[model samples]
Target chain A: MQEVVNFIDLNLIMVGYLFIVGFTGGLVSGFIGSGGAFVLTPGMMSLGVPGTVAVASNMCHKFPKALVGAIKRYKYGQVDIKLGLVMAASASLGVQIGIKIQQIILEKWGQAGSNLYVSLSFVLILVTVGGYVFYDARKSARRTDTAGEMVSNLARRLQRIQLPPMIHFKTADVRISLWLTLPVGFATGMLAATIAVGGFIGVPGMIYVLGASSLIASATELVIAFVMGLGGSINWALHGMVDIRLTLIILAGSLLGVQLGAIGTTYVKEHMIKIVMGTIMLIVAFSRGFAIPQYLAQLKLIEVEENTIRILSAVSFGIMCLALAVGAVIILAAMWKGRFAAEEGAELPDKGSSLEVVSQES
Target chain B: MSGRSYARRKRPYGKVIGFGMLTAALYAAVYLNAPVVMTYFTKGGVYAVLPIATVFLFSYVHGTFAGSLWSLLGIDAKRTRLQERMEKRPAATRKISRPRPRLHA
Candidate 1:
């Protein structure tokens, strides 16, 4: 009795949609330690779910997935639980504040303006950060034919800060001021509220700004993701927006995907992780970028063809899928090459220069 | 720390039965009488119990299930290998510290 897509009922065949999206999105999350949500919410909406239900269900599913991923990484000694928790606590606070600002815009200008604001944020932040990560990864890949170098001068400088209350993060292998961490974590939550994908900022912030290694940053992100997702879901669930069926189905795929991705982390080098994270972020940014014009039209900045809008939305979703596909390929290929090389030798641990951090956990 | 010790321990059947019963009761409360459960869960009141309880429940049951299920399927992460490769996360860790040269020079 629910709405259909292409003559298919959203409520009925939703099971199939959930399974595929869950599996592939989970695959991406496992590789990058974040990003399944970017795919999940939109995938559900495409099945004719209300925007509220899609976001709520996605959040509901996210925490458990992150929890599982975190535990796996912990066993790998990649998670800085203390750091993740601190960031999570602050990020949740930021989420509330961000939500308040979103509400203000929504109340004042209504839905179109709110949607425009979110799309614009997504386009803006993703483009800036994602493009940078992608470029860095490409450059490093060229020099050494490996993917493990840190290109962010910012992280190195942050590490040199000698501010008070210095804290040591074992997995991250850095001792930095606690104050520096707050802004990164807070920005993560704010962006999460604005665009619903905070890891795009969180992972980069941790690696580049906070001076944590890519491996630890990606893994620790699961902890922060768990906290934020749980908090958001509860807020949304109180409104009956979470469809438990939808949440559970996605979890089925994600659980398996997270396990694989977690194991993958053991086999890859450090920089490869950044490569995957940056690649996904840039592609997703582009996906959001395409939708900006449509939202602008809604705000009457310009009037474009309705067919053009529909086509653009379709293209955005396609790019999102392509992002996931590319991530999976990078992870698999890197791991394969590593395993082959490791087998021929004495399993010599690749130096910091040659390691891949992100997918090694998977 | 070794897998050998883990292979020796046996959990009591009574404990397993008790846990199963508690889990069954929870499912009954949430799924069987969903309308009544939904009443409190979706209230959106100041109590905040509905959403908090749901996350707590999922975190426990589903979390454990995913963990053990992966182990059961032999999908566990390789501990020794991971210990070697884990660097501070790739995002924040500075693998390089070379400063840029000044253009004026």
Candidate 2:
């Protein structure tokens, strides 16, 4: 209904591509509680959106979707809002500081250097943390008696501390000091600013470092996400870079995906959450890792053909999409199976049974 | 049984229509003003309040509508376990202990 802008028309093709991207990304976000943005931003750019517009529009869409997902998950008693909010607030500050740091890098090294830094950070965090998560999940899945309890030693040990301004996250069932919580939120923001998805670190940091359970951590990350996305979107929108059409398109699919993802959370083990995140992260690392050499070539640190670089970039984006796709599949499959089991589990316990107390608690 | 049951419990049609129109209007206003609103919001420093304020506004208007819309559709969560848990709140609670004090790099 609007006049066409550039050659980039908001025709059926653009709309359809964005919808699919949103669906896939939303599916991933719902399960992992964070993602989609990393790929969404780039995906939009491919549709001829300016890099800044893609980021801003993606951010605009992300917060609402996250809010939707968080609320849905909260109903399941998974969200720790206070924790998420506090973390989000501090994370906002971290985003500011992280942006400043990026600006400094941008000034000194220019685009090539900045790109390298972003790429390097992506590889390091995604590979190390993602690999660790995959390993831990595999180990946990080997045991059946434990069922949904993959609480980390770090979280358990951290819960023992008594610091000032201590917050009690009822959902997480752990009370870590505000001092410890600040850094988690801050780092989460910093990394989010750098890598586009705070939950990549926020979720893991909560579990392995701050000691929140996976369910609580993933749910809580949504809070941090809404905060960061709001802050970041403002920054980009200020530049007049947000493409509202793109934002809305992504929102349509993500809203549905996130809702499904949130509901999907109900059917899986806590460790499955870790497994999903870790697997995606590790795969994404490979996705980004493949392009490192080309960036190096750009810096003249290595010699590579332009054709080679172009191929690597395409491959890299392909892998990123694949990673998101795989995550969506795992989450949906797990949720479906979990729901089936839950339905079966729901049977034996009749309305007036003694198990009513347990059902009510749930 | 299904969401069909939840749908039966939704508020009347008039209220739903009113809410929907209001939300659509609110979003229209925000999007139409995005360029200026967003620019001033991200000015940084004291101007940083712009972004934060807009977010709060969006959260309230957009967030509430989204929540209610989902609920009306019978897509609401199964009821919050956190609320029941939060009800057990006490006068004072101790913070979780930290073995290693994390430092920023």
Candidate 3:
């Protein structure tokens, strides 16, 4: 039997919806380096595109977007290419393992089981990681002297270990054991393969565990994303799963949004990246949690009315969109404020200095 | 820098328009002949290269166009004096602790 490609008919409205979503997703991705896919894949599926095609097309768009972003940041002297390449190599291996595990689960328990596993992983990883990032950002925001970037305690401990073959990351300005860097990259690749949004983990891991600044971590994640996305896109393309039309249209919008988002990074403080990332992560975690019940019901793990399940699914999707929108809003608002402050010659106080100055003046 | 001075920065209008037209033409061709392109693209074998190549082509052409378009609009990264100083500074070094061999007790 010949397999039919499920391509959705594109009306003007659908094109507009995709463009807007792509732009917003691109904006978030450019700022953080890994968020656009989390929104884009689900957005495409909602528009009647099949799950496989949506994932494939999103992957197709991701590499190009990441490539463009990486180039832009590299010019800004933010990207550490050597670090990015090393991480990417290990991440590619992790992706293979992740895909194999996904395939095994699909074969064992079918679609419902596969979905439940994905959701469970999403919820578990996002909450723990996101909560910690949020707490760290808030704590950093409250400090009185913000002369330097705050290195996480874990990262400090990791850097102290006298492991041989410590490769120096010049741009990120950290020298750590090459062995420690592999796990961060591998975990990034694994999560990326599983969730289609690996940057969330990759960026945070670099900052908190590896001691890279938020700027360098976010910029470097684009390199990892580019490598993994290219590999994923090739695999999907080989299966004839990519819809070129969808990929191009999304790319058109993202190309513009991503540049803006990358520029946004320069105007704002480093902690802003963490704030946006943590906020989006927590919200998306909640959204996935909302969808898990329906998958559970499908697996006969729980009994729920069809109407309630439908409502839960809709809310889950709505929350995902909301999370992306909230992230975009925060990025744009901060960028605007930063730009305005710069233009007016109103030098913004360093992160923790604002409160101290206000008290002293009073 | 004042807004006027920033606006005076050279804009890549020529590159923007040139790539813009090329991008538009490519998009038009794809949309107009969607069926044929779709058929070949989904053939699922050696033909998979079509979609992959097509996206890479669009990204390069259109990505350049989008970048120029933003520069023309005066939406750019702020090159603050502080940022310049930070970029010029030497890379910070971390103290590497060497492991000492313990004598046999």
**DockQ winner among the candidates?**
3
- Lowest lDDT 10-residue stretch of candidate 1 chain A: A1-10
Cα deviation of A248, candidate 3, in Å:
0.4
Colliding pairs, model 3: none
Task: Give the higher-lDDT candidate: 2 or 3.
Answer: 3
Cα deviation at A14, candidate 3, in Å, is 1.5
Question: What are the candidates' individual DockQ scores?
Answer: 0.15, 0.10, 0.30
Question: Per-residue CA lDDT of candidate 2, range B1-105, in tens?
Answer: 233444457554554466667757865775677666545544445664454455445445554554456556544433323445545556467887978878979
Local accuracy of candidate 1 as per-residue lDDT tens digits, B17-54: 55446655665556566556545554554434565566
Over B1-105, each residue of candidate 3 has an lDDT whose tens digit, in order, gives 445566678999999999999999999999999999999988777898898889889888999999999889888887643344347767679677988888999
Real contacts recovered, all predictions: 0.27, 0.10, 0.59
Question: What digit string (tens of lDDT, one per residue) describes model 3 on residues A173-193?
Answer: 788999999999999889987
Q: Candidates' interface RMSDs, in order?
A: 5.3, 5.8, 4.4
TM-score winner between candidates 2 and 3: 3
Give the number of the best model, judged by lDDT: 3
Could you give candidate 1's per-residue lDDT for residues A54-172 as a string of tens digits?
A: 88878888887888788877877778888898888878877878899999999987888898888778778887888887776666556444334553677678778899888887667
Question: Could you tell me the lDDT of residue A32 within candidate 2?
Answer: 80
Against the reference, the lDDT scores of all candidates come to: 0.72, 0.72, 0.85
